[model samples]
Target: MTIYCDESGGLNAGAMTFAAVMLSPQVAADIHARFRSVTGLRGELKGSRISLVERAYLLELFDRAGGRAWVAMARRDTIGGKPGGAVPSDLSVYAALLNLAVGRWLPETGGVCTDVVIDDGRYDPVILGKVREEIQAGLGAWGRASLAESHRSDGVQIADVIANSLFNIAAGSPRAHRIQRIIEPMLASKAIRVAELKDFG
Candidate 1:
């Protein structure tokens, strides 16, 4: 099974989007449990907020998850703008990156996957559609893919908080925020940030 985590912006930046995708329920539960244990979390990891403990737990989870995990960034694409005018929103860009990550994880059989989940947030169906298209294209004609979106007021907040902390850990918080300005637009539309074992450049 493969689980992915990603982020849309950094701390230097004002806002960011992040997400996590897992194919196996057992693995997902184990990852969540490990993180909770590290953080000493007694309640649900729902909502949009995360504490320092939670952040630490996530780092540990990543370490155990292995390095092959995938990560993608929506940094300046050489033109200081979206790759193309058609994908103008941050959500679309995030979706595009998600597509790329999922593309990389497709099984050889090209079977359809439907256990996917996305956090609830501000975004348009149009951008989501584009992301869906990208995911399908990535799978080719062999396998199929499906999307599932859900709301957890707490999880959303937790995702944002954790994402910011991860960015800080990567570099300095100051730089992370600075990068946020440039990266937020790319992440604006994502349901949540995804995580991978590899570092982003």
Candidate 2:
């Protein structure tokens, strides 16, 4: 399986989220094609740019595609952030969380090799490159990690949606209530694994 990674939220929202969405290559391509046919998406499909109905529909596709997700969240009023004017340290925690999320699905035994693609939307190439290398060092011989722009990646874009949806819920956004309804079944069934980083700095 190939896992796509992305991050959402920040200190301004009192939280940060990093998510990994795992899917077969074919499924990822299919989902992208289907979503585009339905929405006529001209450019990158971003969670922040989509409507509630579209969000619901995408989640439905994820469900049907049997997509699995793992998310790590840090809740702190003074935590590292990737918002405007972000520092390199701001991505340290996010990288840690990304590692945690991807580790969840990695096979501990047997020979298994998986690809990890992270969205390079938040920081400059050099800093995010370091994060990619950090993740690479941990992948062992069974996994590979790399960074890609979300707009160019359907998997990364979907990862963004997953991260964004949960961020809204944890941040208590006005639409969280409705968004919760759309994803309640997946949460209940544990198709999407969400764990808050407890006692996190």
- RMSD (Cα, Å) for all candidates, in order, is 8.6, 3.7
List the lowest-lDDT window of 10 residues for candidate 1: 150-159
Worst 10 residues of 2 by lDDT: 80-89
lDDT of 1 at 44: 54
Off by over 4 Å in 1: 2-6, 10-23, 37-48, 65-68, 76-79, 82-88, 107-120, 140-144, 150-201
Question: Per-residue lDDT for 29-103 in model 2, tens only?
Answer: 899889889988888887878999999999999989999899988765444434674533446668768877877
lDDT of 1: 0.44
How far residue 119's Cα lies from its native spot in candidate 2, in Å, is 0.8
Q: Which candidate leads in lDDT? A: 2
lDDT of 2 at 35: 88
